[model samples]
Target: MGSDSKQVSKIPKIDLSGLHPSVAGGERWEAAKAEVAAALFSHGCFEAYFPSSSDELREAMFGSALPEMFALPLETKRRLKSDDVYHGYIGQIPHMAYESIAFDDPVSPTAVEEFTKLMWPEGNSSFCKTVEAFAKALHELVEIVQMMIVESLGVEKHYDSLVSSTTYAVRLSEYGVPLNQDTKIALDPHKDPNLVTVVCQSKIDGLEVQTFDGDWVNVDPSPNSLTVMVGQAFQAWSNMRVRAPYHRVRVLGKEKRFSAIFFSRPSHNSMVKSPEELGDEDHPLLFKPFSYTEFVKFLYSEEGRKAKNPFNAYFRIGNEEAA
Candidate 1:
């Protein structure tokens, strides 16, 4: 569905440059917190802008490296394939027109090294190095965004600890039209299974978010900004105070679309539950505590695919079956 430019124009834009001083409770911090809170509660999504220097670094790496890697032949790309959903190349599937390669926790040197070998067995160290640098830069930006999200929810105390040990998975996706002109869903509608998802879309627009009233509105691509969507983990952590908006992608026209999506999540063993500060008798823990691993398994399970909100299925208030 084509997005009404007017509707897309109204999506909130959040500048994260001032998030640091705000964390220490600066003047700018209050305004930033209010902006973020309003955006999350009202729209469940917002466009985020980092400092110009950081944006330049991200654009240089993702803007170039992703296109080059996707341009590789099918067989060459398949060399990095794996059955694991968290890692390796996922070739184009039935409803989706995109092919993606996922790298786990790009900030880790060991993880980066292993991923580089798998992606370029023939020894393209330069490409690997470039990706590592990009990952490092992106990770820094993610930390800032995570803090903003946590602080916006009025849980500023947990910001540092929550983000410090979190794991980030980066996926580079390439979306294109089918040769047969068959109607295929570019990306299906689903809520992310992480705390938050930060996506930098290349200048074509195809992303859409489902509004509270059940209408889908297009998230048009904007220059030098990343579209941030709240994920299931955040919903659970906020005890449903924050929503995980369902979103999808569509092919707009002749051009192929590319995006660098970073999924931010807690450590595998970290227990995800609503912050006690956010709960009371009125909203006594809406979700049961669960680990990231349990959550991931549910996301890939049959029940998860069928459930409208997997978080609810797994931890909602007393469905006898879930209990």
Candidate 2:
């Protein structure tokens, strides 16, 4: 709730309990959609109060399942491998305490089962069930958030295809930190390149998002709420109408931090493009249509990191002569 800059406005909070179609009236849904659009454009992130994220669900994930998974031998955890970036086990770096494993299509039962079985070769049905249930619940929130973004942008016509063309991934991370008095920066500041990133953090205050005014704000979310963030691909898809906040995790308190991050991105073969109407006089074509897969390649490449404006440098519509 408190940001470094006292002048910075608090991050917007949206109630998404109106998940059931008939439960929420047309007017209320529309208002929520508008709020989502405004928040993304303004802060590039918001805290969502989703009542469905019960305490039991949170405990199953943060309390036991994740802890046990991380407790596995390093070799056992590394068994879940992948060729894709950040999709497999990543940790045990020289000095960093961060460790993570991501599962694609986490909403599907298969992905969850595969990961669980890999860690527990013989069998571990409980972990599989908990992960599947948690991811499925989170997926519902992601779907509606994406829908709200598209609808608020006046591109509701493309919503169906957009949904179909998306692939989801969930990354679970745990940070190892000593109980030192000094604050430690666990991760550097960076914006996600996907469409949207929704994160559920264990009850530790660490995640921070930068405000438009160049100030960082702590995202202290409630147990029943998930913090949703806009990402670069969505910024481009919305013709730069939505901004992605640069965020990082800091170990303010002397405690290890754990987080579950859910990402919804375009399928590997799908393209990321904004509606022609989005490129009006005020917002001339800032970026061109580019492949999400290729962009991701550049995102993790040396050139991408060196470039000050990676997305624009990679696919901007104008400035052919600048190069």
The top-ranked prediction according to lDDT is: 2
| Alpha-carbon runs more than 4 Å astray in model 1 | 1-7, 18-24, 52-59, 79-86, 178-184, 316-323
Candidate 2 whole-model C-alpha lDDT, 0 to 1: 0.81
Name the 10 consecutive residues with the lowest summed lDDT in model 2.
1-10
lDDT of 2 by residue, 125-217 (tens): 878888888888888888888888887788878887777889999999998773332446677678898999999999986788888877887
The TM-score, computed over Cα atoms with residue i paired to residue i, of candidate 1 is 0.85
Query: What tens digits encode model 1's per-residue C-alpha lDDT throughout 91-205?
Result: 7676557798886777787776777676567766666776677666556666665676677767878877776657888888888874435443488777887887888777777
How close is every model to the real structure, measured as TM-score?
0.85, 0.91
**What value does the lDDT take at residue 102 in candidate 2?**
87
All models: lDDT?
0.72, 0.81
| For every candidate, C-alpha RMSD to the true structure in Å | 3.7, 3.4
List runs of model 2 lying over 4 Å from the truth.
1-9, 20-25, 178-183, 316-323
